[model samples]
Target: MKVNKKMKTSALAGAALLSLQALPASADQEYLLTITRPGHLQVIDMSTNEVVRTCDVPGKFGTGSIAPSPDGKIAYVLSNMTEDVYGFDIQTCDITFHAAQSQGNVRVKTHQSITVSADGKELYTVQNPVRHLPDRFEVMEPQLAVYNTADGTDAKPVRTFPVDRRITKIAATEKGEVILGGADIKAIDVNSGEVRMVTALQSWDRGPEWLPPDAFAMHSQGEQSNEYIMPYVTAKFQDDTMNMETAEWWWGISRVDLATGEAVRQEIIPFEFIVFNFISDPRDPNIFYGSFNTLSKHDITTGETLALYEMPHTYYDLNISADGKTIYVGGTSSDISIHSSDTLEKIGSIQLSGDMSTSDLRVATIRD
Candidate 1:
């Protein structure tokens, strides 16, 4: 039986409308979508920074991975409670559909393993079991499951195929291919299921000691000013020599060229601070942002650290507006903190109706 979830709008103040009306309107609407840890969704009006609507997700312990529809009218989330996926209408803040990622003793979703295509017609995610009890659970090879968004409530994978064993995050390209980023970056042909490796996270390593990536650092992969940004941290390179052990573990950002499939690594000056999420400036691709416990700005061009600010709490997710002005950070709290992207200054905060430990904040465009 599906669990009963609450769906309601927060008590928005009338004065809030007056403030929202003051802002100049655009052809497209903007909203901050927050998925809480208590398993709920909150859609906040970016104009007033107010919670316009909220819906309790079906799953209890929801994962931090959601992809907004092309129109931003709906969000398809890969949930973990019972290992299923649910779609919520962005307008009504109600459950629109529910489809299990795996069925009958099978499970999926490692972390941030869900994303929609560029055109927003399909969904992609990695299916990995959570438990490995010998007799109680049946362990299976990890696979990539593709589903059609139009399928509605009982949606099932139109096609399922084996992908890399450790793909934690999934994204798509404009040219009609799936980009899986984790320990290694690769492309897969949806129709043909051809996996082509683009590059490894340790691509910058000069010696044979290749460092595996911290997959938790990955967020949604989207084009910003014609360039794609990927944030990831690498595991330590343990060596008996004191110099190697004392040497800081390098964090990196991968910049990929969509046109030519050329991927380059931007290694940060070793261990000043750790950045686990990626947010790049739309106007200037050279400039990028990263956050987990702290928000950081980086100039990948000259390998220089620009600014760093500690967030109130450790946030697992981050998002930026289409105009490249405001930065939204959520995922581990009831409030979505807003900041000036240019300065990383706290500009405002929107408190959710419930203390829904929201996970991922996805910024997308909604049509008026």
Candidate 2:
């Protein structure tokens, strides 16, 4: 597809150069940031469970992946068919930064891999570029693109390095590395571009008794827990015969600590159903929640189901409140459902103007 120069120019002229405004002032408040179809960023106040503010996102909306700055002042969204990145000031709803990944005949897609540094000075993503020839398309190598947040409106990658393909999620670590989740869990240094194995997912050494696990980590809701957690499913042979009928399927979790870059992987429970996403409890280390067609609570340490409640519909992503009292399920519909963490019961819901699609439901704490 070709670039829309007129739309890009108009969006830049209207959003750029706007002065930042003060949000409803508060010493410390938790808000949920999410995007919906047709391009809109909505902020929900955790205290009132209401859509407190709505911001217009520039460019066409497709896979609206958002990564908020450290201070929660700016939200960088990957939109425009996953080829453009725009940073919106949450308070003023102004486009603070914009970067179109594609150039000329090469079309680049980030594939939902976007993140910001801990200090909020840099942004990172893995770009898969394909060159469109007159009669054929040439596949190019994937690279990690890093952008400075201060470069407004016409931002470009300050640096880029080659990386492995199929990276779907990127999370920054406090130790100057970004944890990449895809075929395997790996950490790449932002400065040196040094890549190291954090944990083996597809290449896990589980002996000849277990089948390789299948997992996908897309949502970026680890702010409250300070960890990137993902759910997976695998089957283990129950006997020496290694018969398919005697295999026991199980659910497991792999976690990467954002502060230390430490990784942990373990099977959690028997695979009973599919879970699209999972979030750990900030208040309790042993507790976590999963969402899809149902809301289920699990004991991370014991691999036990603590509580389970069927939901009204499917939700692609789920996040926890800072206080750990309420759980919010979103990303598959117009309404984000609120539930009690202790009982897993629906308590309330926040309805948006449009469907969330594959957008992330991120919890950010804004301070005065």
Which one wins on lDDT? 2
Each candidate: what lDDT? 0.70, 0.88
TM-scores for every predicted model: 0.82, 0.91
- Expressed as tens digits, the lDDT of each residue in 261-292 for candidate 2 is 99898898778877888888899878888899
Number of clashes recorded per candidate: 8, 0
- lDDT for each residue of candidate 1 in 146-230, tens digit (9 for 90 to 100): 8888888898989987876666666676666777776678888877888887766644454534455554435663533444467
TM-score of 1: 0.82
RMSD of each: 11.0, 13.0
Once model 2 is optimally superposed onto the true structure by TM-score, how far is the C-alpha of residue 239 displaced, in angstroms?
3.0
**In terms of TM-score, how similar is model 2 to the real structure?**
0.91
